[model samples]
Structure formats: C-alpha cells, structure tokens
Target: MIIIQLNQRQQKIIEIVKENQPITSENIASMLNVTRATLRSDLAILTMTGILDARPKVGYFYTGVNQINLLGNDIKEKKVEDMMGMPVVVKKDVSLYDVIVEMFLSDVGSIFIIDDQENLCGVVSRKDLLKATIGGLDINKMPIGMIMTRTPNVVTVKREDSIVLAARKIIEHEIDSIPVVDMDDEHNVTKVIGRISKTNITKLFLEIAGE
Candidate 1:
C-alpha cells in the first residue's frame, strides 16, 4: 500500500479540493493566494496519500475513504427492512413514564406507539416528552396514547423500495423517519413493521461515502 503523508499545506489542499471538488489546481491556488505550482505540489501529495484522484483533463477530487462494510455500494439494491432496527414499540395504555424508561433503555430518539389492535396509532419523540415534562405534566399519570400524535399522517414506503428511494422521502419531507408498514393482500396497511430514520440514511451515506 502506498501511504501518502500530508503536511499542513497538503492537508489544506485536500480541504480546498473537498470544498470545490473536481476544481482546477489553478482555481485553488487563486483562492488561497498561492502559486499554481505550490497548489499542484500539494495536490500531488494528497493524491499520493490516497485521499484524492487526479484526472487527466478533469481536476482533483476526493475519493470516498473509510468505506463501511461490504454493503456500502450495494445499498441501491438493498431494502429498508434489511437494515431496520428491531421493532421497539409502546402501547396506548402504557404510561408516559414507562415509555420514557423504554426510550432511555433503548437509547433511541423516538418510540413507535401502537393501538389496541397493534396498528400504528402515533409516535412519541424525546421532544414530546420534554415538552410535557416542562409544562409540569406528570409523566407517571399521563398515558402515552393521550399525548401521542394520533395516526400522525404517517409517511411510509414499501418493503421492496430501495434505500436510495427511501432516502429521497426523508430529504423531501424533512422528516426524521418514516414508518415501514406491511400491506395486506388487499393492499391496505396491516401494521408497522419497522422504521427508517435520518440516522439510518446517514449511516448508509457515510458507508457509501467511505468515511
């Protein structure tokens, strides 16, 4: 393996390249108020370090480094269910205090609230609990179902949808997560099986970005 050691200047060059990737060395030099030759030398050092790839006519760009496991590049073909976390759920009758305890134990940002029929009823987030607590509402006395968002106008995706497509829903909706619902033979939502969160997309992106 060729290890390219970067000096302070070379590191700065890499940062510049990252900011204006596929940008010419001349443009970088102009931005940094340095000679093109100096920038070129820095770029060369970074390229040697495996942090960048220089094309003949194109320019310098950062390569995806520190890739995740073998699944990184394959996410486009992967489904959300494959990467989803185990279903962590709460019932409407459960006390808010119980839900809080579960949230802490699971170390998750939100909890899936289900109804008596085991269908998705609502969602409760850390913020929701905090808002209630701050307002002097008793956690132990409050039922999660009473405070939870009812039927939340949930956004969901089919189990067969690709991770890339699922990611777009997150970005476009500006939502933190989407419930993964199972459709019955008649094409109606039967129940929520999993959740896809921003954190999930971030992990996938970091994986594919190799860092």
Candidate 2:
C-alpha cells in the first residue's frame, strides 16, 4: 500500500469522519468551524489520496488504517538534505549591523557565520541581535563573530542525517533553524550547505498530504 502522511487538520477530518460516517461536507465544515469552500481542496486531496471515500448523497468515510504509524515511520526514514533549504550565510567579520540587514534581506530567522575561507564558524539568530541591541552595544563597530553562537556549541545536522533527528535538535535546543553541514573525515564541519527550519518541515508535511 502507498502510505501518505496527513497533517493535523487532515487527521482531524479523518477522526470526525470515523466518528460520524456518512456526514455531509456541509456538516463536516460546520463541525470544523470552516466554510464548505475552504474544505473543498482538503476534501479533494483526501479523496484523491484514497484516504477518504465519498459517496453520492452520502458523506465521507475513512478507508485507511495505521495512517499515523506509517506517517511516523516515513518521517523517521526521510533525509534532511531532501527537505533542507539553501543556507543564508555571512562572514564572521561582518558588522553586527550588516548581519541584521542580511537576516532581513534573506528573510531568514537565522544566519550562518563563515570564515575567510568559507568554513563554518558560528551562527546568529534574531534573538541574538535583539539581545545585543538591548544591551546598548555598538552594532556598527562590533563584529558578529564576537556575539554569535560559536562552533562546537552550534547544533548542526549532516545532510544525510534523518529528518527526525534534525526535528529533535530543533525542539530540544529551542531553535528556529539548523545548519545542514558537511563534515571532514574527522567529523569537523567543513561547509554550511543548507538549512532546515520549522517551515521546511511544515512544507514537507503538506507535500506528503498532497496539498
């Protein structure tokens, strides 16, 4: 069987259908506090994915089993590189002011810091810049490297690592983004190749659900 992962809203829809089989789309929308039109796309996706079966004059019915377990296994087996976004990077010697500007221009929550040779050195987040501002430090004169979360302390993931592991690192460390790194034979970070964020994970879930 081809197992497809469902998002939270999709799972909720399945639950409602299971409990109240043959329920009309109008009633389902009312129960979920959404417009029937709003649910049209979701319904279409579920039906097309074979997760739900809709009958004329009847309602929606659940047709799959062990969906949650299968989804969990699928996520565990997925690789980080497949879902990672391009990394936004800055030189370690970049001015603190410039770093903040780069973060805004790139529209990323975090930025990777690299050295003259383009080696991974550190990472800076919006929170870090905020703290620096609140501290009344000179943003223009200070180099971002001085305030960045340095290597050995930065939480990173290998491109080939499981996405599940990367997700755990995000949750455990309370970070918004993680740098996907390539390492040398000795396991030292050699390059900042990509990034994985909560948004990336959400997009992956949506894609799996055929949305």
Candidate 3:
C-alpha cells in the first residue's frame, strides 16, 4: 500500500515511460510477454487508484511528474480555494505533549498553530517539540507558542497558487509540509497542507507504472 517496493514488471513499465515511448496495454504485454488481458487489469488497477492518467489517446503514463505539470497549467483555469485542505488547526495554548500526540495521530510531521482569531501565528515541527522536551522543559506545562516558529519566517503557499508550486516548495525548502495561506489577507494560513511526500510522489509513480 505504501508503494515503496515494486515488482520487476512494474519497474520495467516505469523504465519504458521514462524513455518517453508510446505506452499501451498491447505494447506492454508484447514487451513483457504477458497477456493483453493481464496488462489491462494492471492498467485498470493503476488508473482507477489515481496512479495513472488515461489520456484520450495516449494510454497509460507516469502521473506524478506529468500530472503535477498538468496541474500547474490547469491552475490558471481555477482558484487555489478549490484544492486546499480544510481548516484543521491547533491552538497556541495547547501543550507540546498534546501537539506531539496530535502530530502522530494525524500522521503529519508539521502542524500549524493559530491564535484565537484564527490567524496563523506559528509553525511547529517534531524537532521543535523534541528539542524542548530533551532540554528538560515540561511539555505539558509549556505552551506550544513558546516553541513554535514565529510568523514572517515560515514557508507557506497561497491557496490560489498552483499545486506544482506547492510541491516545489516542499522540495526546495527540504521540509515535509507547508501551510496553505490566503494571499488576499496577510498570508493567514487557511489550511495546513502537504506535498511531495513518499505517499504522493513515489507511491503514485509505482502505482501508475503498474507496480
């Protein structure tokens, strides 16, 4: 399910795509010496799972890179509010322990901390919490606000920005995630979103490649 380890045939399909060759079930079956029906099942399973994109005439191709670029060009036709995550927030007054627990339970490495007015006040990372606790600070008593990275320094993406831009930010910043902020305001994070994780990039590639 994680899509990290892939089978040999799946890896071969990806290699073909990487070569920019015409990819199809028939072609794949002939190349791999498999049945056309079997190849169809593989493609169907991949495309239906969001790992592959079936173009009108182009058949199957890698979705991670191409899909992201397509999303970039298509973004000009839509708004950021259409794709951003909903408002899921953590309060500044919450304890670091609680924040860590939330991070694990939510399966996110980074979390956004907001003020009472719902404004993005600070950003917290697992490292921040770990450092505080290892320094002999009481996680339960210390407010997350004391350890969070303050505003004007946190990396953020606007809701209206292209998803490609969001993915690029994650790579360029070497960060696990970013906050989706509203540009109309003073860059207040309306949603906490993530991109470029192994789940999105590698797994997607494997599945699309029919792994």
Compare the candidates by lDDT and give the number of the best one. Answer: 2
Among these predictions, the greatest TM-score belongs to 2
Indicate whether candidate 2 or candidate 3 has the larger TM-score: 2
Q: Indicate the TM-score of model 1.
A: 0.59
Query: Model 3's lDDT to the true fold?
Result: 0.67
lDDT of 1 at 176: 69
lDDT of 2 by residue, 132-205 (tens): 98899999999999999998899999999998899899999999999999889576537999999999988877
Q: What is the TM-score of each candidate against the true structure?
A: 0.59, 0.66, 0.54
Q: Against the true structure, candidate 1 has what lDDT?
A: 0.77
Better of 1 and 3 by TM-score: 1
* Model 3 Cα lDDT, one tens digit per residue, 110-149: 7888888777888887778878889999888888999999
lDDT of 1 by residue, 148-189 (tens): 877745567777787777789988966667777786747544
Query: Superposing every Cα of model 1 onto the true structure, what RMSD results?
Result: 8.6
Error of 3 at 122 (Å): 1.3
Candidates' C-alpha lDDT: 0.77, 0.89, 0.67
